[model samples]
Target: MKQDDTTEGAAESTDAFGGLTPAEGLELLRVGELTVQGRLAAASNATLYCTVSDGLRSAACVYKPVAGERPLWDFPDGTLAGREVGAYAVSEALGWGTVPPTVHRDGPFGEGMVQLWVHGDETVDLVALARETDNEALRRMAVFDAVVNNSDRKIGHLLPTASGHLYGCDHGVSFAEEYKLRTVLWQWQGMPLTDDALTRLAALRARLADSADPLRQELDRHLTGPEVFAVRSRVDLLLRHRVHPYPSPDWPAVPWPPV
Candidate 1:
């Protein structure tokens, strides 16, 4: 997907604080501008962290990047920052529930974005949370992930807020528009769609049909037209082919473990 779009120094960073841990990342901050902090959570190809700014006085920022992440394929640089920004922007534009404002930054660490921290009372476990899958809210959450082409959404990424609203994190690999719908939400398969759920999908369909106008401009450019149509097809398929068992728990993890 044109991962080669940016080269080193092409995208700038405000400041560089190298090799910081999640705890350490919270300590470093600057206000008004985005700052590159230390690595937070590391996956096969990316790290999660709090991009800090001292002036802001806010301690923690949460984001996932493929900074040290390796090439999943022959094309494009596998770095996380730029790709996440694209996917996040696209998802946001399509009017889905997604990460809050991500600050696109130019910095020494290369191009990347910062995500608003999701406050979860405890660590997330999909199977555990699956217990609550029947709840309309949770079901909607899974379905949203599916529709967004959110391939990296693991059970771990769904944070359970204190209020019980499940927040999704790490969406770098979303919006490919083909073979991109990945997640574990089949537990509610065949469950009748609430008016709200059906409405959300219907609304998304309305947006996609207007792809000439573009529901998400970023996706319009990044994903091919046919691919975007495929995405729409998958969404329709999910609603139609879906069985009562919910998503087949049999699907293996999205190949990229963490966004």
Candidate 2:
């Protein structure tokens, strides 16, 4: 099997198959047959590159099986896949498009997180992009990482696509009840949130409060009660403070091998 496709790498080109809406993509990933094409060896987890097909439509995707997940002393065994899905849910709620269409479902390797593969723009300098203060996309992602309590947001996770969209992946270590945010995009630290961001956060906070909301239901399925509650708490804090958070002194300010 071919290898060497890191999340930072220009992935197997799939721009032609990128026409599907997020809803359509989610449906395909949910019920389609997944055939593993290769392994993304750079991933810490068992991340398999695959194609999902419902006969008429097919697209490249990344599948990280729960069985292949490495144990972290802090996270419960077999829960990483769910956290990945939970992150996708939050991204969708925020309407930020930071995460690709991802779903947790049964695959060749058993149940895991199946995410649409993103073909990153090879020309963008990710290091410089991460350090920029005025890049709206990266700033939005920083807020996202804060809300999810993402413990690992390396420079390599940034995906700047040719379609003028910025996305990020590798969120299997997110949504802890404690404040564990660590990231490379801290240029907006302590800055007041933009009006647009506050509007989105308010909508998300309202949706999260409604127990009957689909977002709440989906989050419940993937996250523990306290973890889900913690997401709400984070949003509340952001709205109350109305500013991007500072790095937590209790946790590492940045991930190792930041790139």
- In angstroms, give how far residue 131 of model 1 lies from its true place: 2.7
The local distance difference test score of model 1 is: 0.51
Count backbone clashes in candidate 2.
0
True-vs-predicted CA distance for residue 82, candidate 2, Å: 0.8
For each candidate in turn, give its C-alpha RMSD to the true structure in angstroms. Answer: 10.4, 5.6
Q: What stretches of model 1 exceed 4 Å from their correct place?
A: 1-31, 54-59, 63-67, 74-83, 86-98, 123-127, 176-182, 211-214, 238-259
Q: How many backbone clashes does candidate 1 have?
A: 22
Each model's TM-score, in the order given? 0.67, 0.92
Model 1: ten consecutive residues of lowest lDDT: 1-10
What does the lDDT read for residue 194 in candidate 2? 87
Top TM-score hit: 2
- lDDT for each residue of candidate 1 in 189-225, tens digit (9 for 90 to 100): 5666655556566666766677465554555655556
Tell how far residue 237 is off in model 2, in angstroms.
Answer: 0.7
